[model samples]
Target: MDALPTDPEPTDTRPTDAAPTDAVLDRAAGAVIGSAAGDALGAGYEFGPPLPDDARVGMVGGGTFAWAPGEWTDDTSMAVAVLRALAAGEPLDDDRTLDGVVDAWCGWAVDAKDVGNQTRAVLGGLAPRTAAAARRSARAFHDTYRRSGGNGSLMRTGPVALAYLGDGREGDLARAARAVSDLTHAEDDAGDACVLWSLAVRHAIRTGVADVRVGLPWLPATRRDPWAARIADAEVSRPRDFDRNGWVVEALQAAWSAITHGTTLVDVLERAVRGGRDTDTVAAIAGALVGARDGASAVPAAWRDVLHGWPGLDAAALTDLAARAVRR
Candidate 1:
């Protein structure tokens, strides 16, 4: 464990047409970098049990896959695919752009250190490799096996929020989140979690407040009440209680539970990593939310200095890419 600030406060500002202030830029960049940081931190503990409260946690690496220290796993790699697509002026709303994302994913998956089971099955067998085709494969995989409610989609969802920020289009944000998630996770639960998380990240980027409930209205009516209750439960429960941390619903619950109980960015991420199974994914999810609220400057300097992953990105490179994404 590391030092955590006490209740870091969020800036009170919204996205504007003018060049973003440093605080906004930091938060935007933080959302991506913080995610990678947590992913790398938890990578070493991928399938392990919860650590004792006082146990040390760092970017040790070498888990289910022997990831290098401070090297992010599939979680950040996939998010980078999305970020690269957006940074290149590709809007995820367009089929062409989504297909570009899938192509990036397939290209990366070939050499990636690890790939989620649900995502691998869909991407490996994709015929056309088109976004539409990927969706079809995802649905088929889900239908035949009834196993698409995994956390793969949610783990890479944070950056989708960056695409529509300051555009004043919450509707587009929700749509893009759902569509992007559907490419691999055709389940309704998967899409719903993405919508909620994307909007939640957008809200944090804009107003500096972290509230997953912000996207509840964007979900179908029947889901609203149930998700609301889930979110409420997360706030009051402990992260370890949601033992099935691989499922989308429980994943969100575990992450939110950690975020709700922790005060600073480091604290939230620590709580998430200590939640046991699927450590990296849960920590990555919580990291994005906390980073949006706290900004990049709030991340521990030690962690940021060493943070890195696929596509040859280190901390500053990731920050510049996020800047491009926000400015674009």
Candidate 2:
């Protein structure tokens, strides 16, 4: 692990008169809306299906199997549940939030919808424990199956980051991220990667375009992880050498680079998506960061309309939660 960054001077450039309530609401609204839109947009291409040339084509269309328009899979559904729990005043540091996360997962499973394999296994294994047993057993269960460094844990973490920004609590944000991720992915790398990404997104939203170098000061000091070194290098490098693996470190680097390299939210997301591999997750991650910086107003209107009516989960309700949770 590389050394984590020292706290940099605050770079918030919103109007001095900007109300706290307004800023929070904007950040929250942008987060949920961006997430749903990214999920819906990428749903067409999930599992590696090609995106339609028209782009506006709702269903996958003839000759190709058509998916129902605006349907989000488990990604957005679980995220909505998480957001609802947070909005109900669950604290990230407390056991209650963990229970809320578990409850949310159970609610989603009741619908018999698609779920990630690792997430399903974790949730299924811990369902029978009483609250105390559930907590202890779940932690042990998470520790047992620790190899899931997949983007699933990272995808739904935006709300936690937004909710905890500027609380001045040491490791609170990172801990919150870990609590959410540890529900399914307790691996150190997965949890740490989620924390790093959440912090980057929060920094972007608060400061418009935070220097990625800021993150270098926060890297752990044990092993000289090449991933941390690579990100640190990208923070100071030229445009051509950035890597875009589907790996979490690569995805974080790509998201930061896209923000620094592009002038608009769509440009950043497009850059992230076109990098391929785990394109959807990368795009979703970038979208959260960009959306925080630019707010929901920066997203395209047509995309918002398409996202609003996505099937199963209520995209609008999630957006509403985002709006309500962060309202100053």
Please write out the lDDT profile of model 2 over residues 1-328, one tens digit for every residue: 2354444434333432244556656655776667665555555554453333224323231122233455555666777766776777677777766676677676566554456666666676565432344445545655676455656677777777666655453256666776777676655566666776677666655655544443333446452265567666655642223333344556566566656666777766655554545545666766777777777777787676556432344555666777555542
Pairs of residues at least 3 apart in sequence or in different chains that clash in candidate 2: 1-223, 3-219, 4-217, 4-218, 4-219, 5-217, 5-218, 21-328
Q: What is the C-alpha local distance difference test score of candidate 2?
A: 0.59
Q: Which candidate number would show the highest lDDT if scored against the true structure? A: 1
Per-residue lDDT of model 1, residues 79-186, tens digit only: 998998888878887999988889889989998879998899999957787999999999999999977899999999988888777655677888889899999998
Per TM-score, the best of the predicted structures is 1
Return the lDDT, model 1, position 42. Answer: 92
The residue pairs that clash in candidate 1, if any, are none
Locate the minimum summed-lDDT window of 10 residues in model 1. Answer: 1-10
Model 1 residue 254 CA deviation in Å: 0.7
